[model samples]
Target: MKITFITVGKTEDAYLKEGIEKYVKRLKHYTRLELVDIPELKNTKALTEEQQKSKEAELILKKVTSQDHLILLDENGLEFTSVQFANYINKRSVTSSANLIFVVGGPYGFDQSVYARANDKISLSRMTFSHQMVRLFFVEQLYRAYSIIKGEPYHHQ
Candidate 1:
């Protein structure tokens, strides 16, 4: 199954961008991985938090297709160990889904509509993280999951 990461906005920091790219490249060796960026909402100074979320949700929904299994990266979602996450990936691949899309919403988080559309939700950690930084963490975790699945030396217990 293909794995796609959909995040809002661009990674402006060069160091973060480089790190994210490194992990994405490593993940490609294990699966068809792609990072899809949803442009940041423009002129948000006047919009309310709910309004911003609604607008961002529209863009996020557009990136997803009917066949894709949508998963949201939410703080209140389920947390998994490296091995469990690898098993999750294995199950999805075995089922032959078109794509496994994991989305990282905008600054204020996802709207109600986005939440309703998600099939599952995952939490990387209990602590909050910047959207750009989350990209790096998420991609690296994905790489680690793949390595664990293959019984490689990259991950340690």
Candidate 2:
């Protein structure tokens, strides 16, 4: 199955961008990987955090199709070990043909409507990280998960 990774804004840091690209290229050896950057909202000086999120939600939802399985990378979502996450991905691949769409929301997180549309939620860690950092982390984890699935030496217990 193809995996769609959607994030808000571009990775501005050159290092972070390079790191994300590395894992993304590695991941493509395993499955189709689509990286999407929903351009950040403009002129937010007057808009409240909630309004910013609301506007972002509109853009995010537009990328999703009814056949896609939307999964949000949320702090309160389920946390899994590397092996367990690999298993989760394998299970989904065996069970469904739908695209696995994962999203990293803007600074304030996802709006309620976006949450409502999600089929599942996953947490990378209990502690919060910058949205840009999360992009690198998530892509690396995706690569790790695939390596584990293939019994590659990329991961160790």
Candidate 3:
């Protein structure tokens, strides 16, 4: 199955962008990897956090399709070990969806509508990280998960 990562804004840090690109290249050796960035909302100084999230959610939802299995990378979502995460990826591949899409929201996180549309939610860690950094972390984890799945000796207990 093709895996897609949909996130808000650009990765402004050169280092972070390079790290994300490295993993994206590695992940392609295992499966189809699609990286999509939804532009950040403009002129948000007057908007409430909720309003910003709502507007962001509109852009996010437009990228999704009915055939895609939507998952959100949320702090409150389920946490798993590296092996368990690999297993989760394996399980998802057997499902009917052609694409398994993972979403990372903006600073205030996802709106209620976006949450409702999600089929599952995953947490990378309990500690908070910037949204841009999360893209790098998630892609690296994706690469790690695939390596584990293939018994490639890239991960150790």
Candidate 1, pairs of clashing residues: none
Best of the candidates, TM-score: 2
What lDDT tens digits, residue by residue, belong to model 1 across residues 61-155? 99889899999999999999988998988888888656999999999889999999999999999999999899999999999989998999999
lDDT (Cα, tens digit) per residue for candidate 2, span 1-157: 8999999999999999999889998987999999999999999999999999999999999999999999999999999999999999999999999999999999999999999999999999999999999999999999999999999999999
lDDT per residue for candidate 3 within 1-157, as digits (tens), equals 8888999998999999999999998987999998999988889999999999999999999998888899999999999999999999988887565689999999999999999999999999999999889999999999999999899998999
TM-scores for every predicted model? 0.96, 0.98, 0.97
Name model 3 segments beyond 4 Å from true.
none
Clashes of each: 0, 0, 0
Reference-based lDDT, each prediction:
0.92, 0.96, 0.93
Model 3 poorest 10 in a row by lDDT:
90-99
Q: Residue 21 of model 3: what lDDT? A: 90
Off by over 4 Å in 2: none
Give me candidate 2's TM-score against the actual structure: 0.98
Candidate 1 residues lying further than 4 Å off, grouped into runs, are none
